[model samples]
Target chain A: MSAALDAAPGRELPVLAVVGVGLIGGSFAAALRRAGKVGKVIGAGRSRDALVRAKGLGLIDEAVALEDAARQADIIVLATPVGAIPAILSRLLPFLKPDALLTDVGSTKADVVKAARSALGDRSECFVPGHPIAGAEKTGPEAASADLFVGRTVVLTPLEENTEQCRTLAIDLWKACGARVVLMEPDAHDAALASVSHVPHFLASVFMAQVSGADDADLRLSLAGSGFRDFTRISAGSAEMWQDIFMANRDAVLQELKAFRALLEQTESALAQGDARELHELLERAAVARRFWGSRSGHE
Target chain B: MSAALDAAPGRELPVLAVVGVGLIGGSFAAALRRAGKVGKVIGAGRSRDALVRAKGLGLIDEAVALEDAARQADIIVLATPVGAIPAILSRLLPFLKPDALLTDVGSTKADVVKAARSALGDRSECFVPGHPIAGAEKTGPEAASADLFVGRTVVLTPLEENTEQCRTLAIDLWKACGARVVLMEPDAHDAALASVSHVPHFLASVFMAQVSGADDADLRLSLAGSGFRDFTRISAGSAEMWQDIFMANRDAVLQELKAFRALLEQTESALAQGDARELHELLERAAVARRFWGSRSGHE
Candidate 1:
């Protein structure tokens, strides 16, 4: 029945195969199944334990080995770490069919796009690189849920070599998952995300490190509340993942760091003068700017 | 009626005069009134309009001029900007009765303590400086609600010279308002909050400035979601208030900013080298530390 249907249509919901069934991958499986967009969803990973659990939990329809899963599937979703993307693509490249749509959900895009293009032979054009700008520090398959993408932005960084069908299919899949999709070239996307995403992680970490080094660290911790907790929350996420993001987008991150340093100097000078009004004015600008922006965003 | 009952010893609930009928001040008044702890809640502020409205909304039993309110009330709460504390206290000093409990809901305790010492004639010992870590970005009397302090912390900074009754009475008032009272010294509270609260605002503002400066600021604003918005939420607070906070705790703010810069450099170098293990290891520490500290403070 499926074979005849596939032969008849323009795009019969492709057999969606997911590799690395962690948070992003598991979420992808759940979203696909819940939306009823894909014909069938398959899970592939090195962990047989995870695969059995994934199938049992109905996170995917069937569990298959990685290489076999890639060869048989019509669309491949790689939701592994940025560092792991190259190796995962390399392993699956020799087996991928021509029409298969290959994509990823890594935070950064340029490096992943390069790796996918090089590893997938002519199927590079079939590759659609993506980043779901949605997360929590909490990870693993147990944390996966179907409605995670609601009201989140899923950014797609399609390369020069990416085919029109690749971009369209990826957009349709994310839209079905209840995400707002935005497109950019891989390099531009990587640059913007480094400033918006990766830099924030490092800044929060440094703030934590300062407090940890304090003589009254224990006291401050007890006194810390929602504002401080929210500010430092992401500092608790995967260090390795953060490191990859920082390294991947070093130039942009450094540029942002410099800007923060200058602001600090100006604030320090203001304090030294005991010029309360002048200091207040500077902080007022920052405060007003943030408040105004939040108002404009409709969330305040 | 209130004075006649108050003169009869423990028969009358002490009156609390909140000096500003904005969100925090109004909420504090409402909470005290709701709990039935105070015999009378009077408001004293420059905004006759807000005071009249606060009375209409039943936030206060009376809206009197600052001096008139100070002459009658047993407690005076300076619930305004840190910069205005000195001037506000100077005006209220002549009207305050002998042994009246003077306190504030200022964010910075050190500055307030200094201002109180300089402003009050003899009963500086009656002054108990405090910060109730309960408020919303929403301001004015209209946004005031009684439940704003239900589960938040109220940190009191009692100087060594401050009387025990002053401390006890302050804590009692906060407890009546349903706040968890945390006691600390003025300098320590200022320094500690500088690390936890003031520094986070600077980090967010500096980071946001770059993004807001971008040619596509509007586009970025639209694409941002709950997490990004949540993380940067406090940046939208009153600039005048934040300016005072940052300026008052300038040294601590600068030190924290420097530490962040160094940490970013380290993270940048690590990312440039693609050191996923080292990066992840650091981030893992930050996540665990933040969770442990943040959760304890009721921030998570």
Candidate 2:
């Protein structure tokens, strides 16, 4: 499937501009380069040092200003945090090529779509909001890999204003990175992510913070095993990025958190009442579901 | 350190019996055999098929009844689910050798210690309540590995009635399996484990149950990425074992759950109120603590 995408006959390899060349952007550039699916790659970010490092690593052909990138590149990917999306979109709108396809690697899609609509107006037709569901806790160009998106999923919430050409291009780009692309409505994407990604990240951070705040935290951490290690792995993600995500997708995340809290309360009540049957059934349902998911997803 | 323990001079290799013959028991017997630290291994469990498999795997020299194992072995390790510990202890008490050392690999220490005291009376001194801080979601003898305890922590809660010789022998047994052994009070061990392990498992199960029970569960599961995979990995654990753990360490797990709920509420309030500063600080604190722990534990 990826081979067909990578070997697109008669399709021109477009010049790619990756704004905010951190793990996500750097990895996208690296993946496309490995697949021989792009022309020159231009890196742009607030961090000059990161762009330089990305160029040195050959993930990008050159480091350029965001405006220069928007003016020259045939495709531009905004890979910055959700909070920075609006300002960056506004900055690029003036220099953006009329035919250039624009997309984002933001975690929250609805907010990014809304920001693009506000910033680009009618030009929003060129934009496709995307989220590649793959990452490590590690960040930055140094941690980026060409295989980061292999066998991962990428969700694209194409705006009604988006041109069919632009949507196709965005899907092809991720497919070339060895990712399975799924399309959903912007709100649907937000709600699904809130349940699967956003709320899980928030809960991990909350759990980690609670444990760390305890007086006997050092002891607790020492006794922590592989289970704790895996459970709180996402808590090590960048604070700024997560804060933006929670704020950007506020309603969906809040709803999911409420649902989670209700389940937690039910569990607590079961334990308090010494309801072994209830507790076991709850755990059995979860275990069966988790094992089934793991089997289907090949994650176990 | 492990080499020192593995090469204990002039110490006679004990005839070992592993009760339950599952992941924990099978692995213990396998590790001791690999280190040449055992004379023989007798496996005892409720499942005759599991015992047969364990014996075929060479994890045990023979399969025996609990009474036969207790009478024959120099060291008996109760590596069953916490809920089964009391019943197993009662059955083994009649035939337990006077000079034999006893230990357990139950997740919760205090309850196991309590059960031992009730079942064995003065003989409880020979039972060192231990928890190996290592596991995978997969259970049974087939999942057991000789290296399962390597570089892991084995926490021992030695009773005040425990003989010095019995305690040392228990510590050495774990050390021979390439584990780092630490002594902790049973209550302290329970509390720390609740914070780091038990509560995290419960939360994962609760979250999984909530998501699985959702109307759009298939969509949510499709979008679930590596973060969700790792966060819910422990939820795939045996339901019966976890139910036993939650019930056995009820107070500590409940206390930890209350603390987690409080922090979760604070986070929800911050998000609801759009208190970005508060939310950012909480996330940052967690990120810092998680990264520090990851670095120290070499888990990242």
Compare the candidates by lDDT and give the number of the best one.
Answer: 2
Q: Please give the C-alpha DockQ score of model 1.
A: 0.50
lDDT of 1 by residue, A184-225 (tens): 877777666655666677778767866776777888777776
Off by over 4 Å in 2: A1-12, B1-12
Error of 2 at B53 (Å): 1.3
Writing each residue's lDDT as its tens digit, candidate 1 over B227-291 gives 56666777767767787787777776676666656776786576667676666766776777887
TM-score for chain A of every candidate model? 0.89, 0.95
Candidate 1 chain B weakest ten by summed lDDT: B1-10
